[model samples]
Target: MNWMDTIENNNSVEPIEFNVVKVDHNISLAEAIQLSVEKSGYEVEFIETFYGIEMDIKIPFLVGTEDDMINVNITRDDYTITIDIDIRRPNTIEEKLDILEYVNDNNGFISFSWNNEEELSLISIWMSRERLDAVDMLLEHRLINIEMGNAYVNDDKELIQEKLAQRGELEVYRDEDLEFNLSGEWNATHGFEYRYILRDINELINAIQEERENILRFT
Candidate 1:
């Protein structure tokens, strides 16, 4: 079943749909749509809709913070992306069963919203299966000499620092337990570029191997 069907059948909540942009002389709606899709790392296929032209794409959604796969359609009408969330509160056994059915029909989750205050930041693209498998193989064989370059500090630094302060470890990492060292660079889109230096290589290797199942599972 499609997301619209799921939302209508399972719950009464209507899908959120709003125009993100209006066709203007400076930037055509098509151009804006193309840019959005490219930045999101998702391909678009144009289709006719009553409103106007629409672009269809599937994107990953997580059950919680952890990487759990659930699929939903991201249907774009000119400048708007329509989304329907599944199972807001699975309070009953029947709802749990419905969720299972939803998972079977949907490609991945669509836990998304337009964060107007923060700007439209595109989602993270999962690592390719080949790359993940190679990383897994390296870890299994105890090949710890590797570098992942840098990662963006996507979480809240201030909150994390406060927690560490309460624990009396104002420094987030001890010298010996420094699994990776962080360095920062400012970027307008992502905010900061935190470079990583793998100190505890074995630990990271183990993590990579353990988390391998999440890679390309939706596809």
Candidate 2:
């Protein structure tokens, strides 16, 4: 699909024809933001809603203070990049997510969602995984399968044995703690918790970008 053409069709959105003859494609966030607002003579705000990304930049009440919660802090390890996003809310998350998702191309290995005494916190850090990337991924999905091998036996099949049968391949990892692996037995199945581990996605993308140049700045 021609995304540019699609954006042009929207009534609320229009394009800005800038003299990109010498503009660097990789402009800094602060600079790009400045240019975007400058294009409107500081009258209109700029937001990019391309693809699945939605972001908006609006001028404050010209004097009154407001909270700017979306903050991205990048730190460096030996061979990993930890982009810690201080998430506030979904609207807050959208801004940072859009920037990082665009920069990383939505290929972070370790993607996780959890609240850290904050609002709708979703932090994703990318690291370099070793030779176990493939196996780890397989195991991850397999674990999910084992957990949900049965779709509420009491609610549907009601065949615990059939559901437990799916754990044959995971016999090696089976044990007392994993008694529920091949068995449709839950440790009191009441609540469901969905955790997002962004490290895995980050590592996957980082490994894919192993040969690419990246700025690993330390602060």
Candidate 3:
């Protein structure tokens, strides 16, 4: 589902935080990025750094200042590569839709904040590439609504669904066993409000990788 429908339908809301997705380590960071940008009708130049590689991927329609471009940071550690993209400037509706569609087609996730004008506001989409040789990515690292929350697993609907499917009843409780623990509250209108916290995000990412069978699932 798209953001507009989801935002309008939700009775209550939480603060929008950065979202992350993981893919396998297949192509080099440089190559994968180059292909992604060039295929999107943008050109990229990589700057090698002591820590890793950096690139400012430029979209023709998005060019104005350096801050308007998409900044990509790549670093390799522990047999996996992480690529983070920060959209420095606010994107138009069309641009946002195009970028989201492209990333989804490429088996990646894009996260960003939304200003819905109504009482609803927060938005984040964490679409993980469930396979090997895929890039692990997070989008929109902007910090907003600081008082609301700062945990990554705030979006725990999927986890809740899995539990319900297995147990036949919603076990609404704090699952400390998971790297990301979930806390629950009873909402009179919404029934149950579950908040997910990233107790150890790294552990979650590694576990996702271990659970992936192969790239064929994605293909």
Candidate 4:
């Protein structure tokens, strides 16, 4: 069965575990990056510019039923790989704090910056060649974080919670454990939303992994 069918057939109550493909550490950083993206079923593009030749790759993620792209740039110097996703500026101090906290929490792998002139918030993931195997996981994480950033932009509390839970930043209660009070509070009424969000997130993750596996299988 295909990945979607696999997701549909998944009945286990455990978290999904992904298999890491072994990468050759002896290879040059550029070659390692090229191999990793290629193995994940993405094409590596070489573009000529005034500075030098640059490597670029575009990966897709799902937003509702629509697809969005995340651009990854790989450079040889210092073996750095940069992933960039632009989000809207936060409208409130609370929103700004939320974004800052998320970045600080994942500071080892992510950083946030705002372009006041451009009126945009930039979320970036940086990694060295040593963590080459983590590229896929980081890509997935970045996409979820982008969704969270946009959630803040749109002032979507439910979506923000869902994204935080997906990243394990927030606690999620089991269906049986949720105690609903009659006050119609946010937690009481929306506690069950996370279950559905988790289900969708799992499906999206599985779909991405399947796409990579299919690409590797034929190539």
On lDDT, the candidate that comes out on top is 4
Please list the residue runs of candidate 3 whose C-alpha ends up more than 4 Å from where it truly belongs after superposition.
1-27, 63-67, 77-219
- For model 2 the TM-score comes to 0.19
Task: For candidate 1, write residues 1-219 as lDDT tens digits.
Answer: 322231112222222111122232333233344344445454446544454344443333321122332111111211222432222333466644544553444332212221112323222222111111223233345443223422112222332233323332212323333211111111212211011111111122233233223221212
- Alpha-carbon lDDT, every model: 0.28, 0.29, 0.31, 0.36
Worst 10 residues of 1 by lDDT: 191-200
**Of the candidates numbered 3 and 4, which has the greater lDDT value?**
4
lDDT of candidate 2 over 26-144, digit per residue (tens): 33222343353456444322233221112232323211113211111111101122334333333455555543543455343433333344434434333432212222234456632
What digit string (tens of lDDT, one per residue) describes model 3 on residues 152-199?
Answer: 233433433333343322232223221111111222112211111111
- How many backbone clashes can be found in candidate 1? 6
Poorly placed runs, candidate 2 (over 4 Å): 1-104, 107-123, 126-175, 178-212, 215-219
Residue lDDT tens for model 4, 101-193: 645664442233333335555555444331111222443456435544542312334544544454342122123222111112223212333
Question: What is the lDDT, from 0 to 100, of the residue 90 in candidate 2?
Answer: 35
Worst 10 residues of 2 by lDDT: 188-197
| TM-score of each candidate structure, all chains considered together | 0.22, 0.19, 0.27, 0.37
* Positional deviation of residue 203's Cα in model 1 after best superposition, in angstroms: 35
Look at candidate 3 and tell me the lDDT of residue 38.
Answer: 65
Candidate 3: residue 25 Cα off by (Å): 14
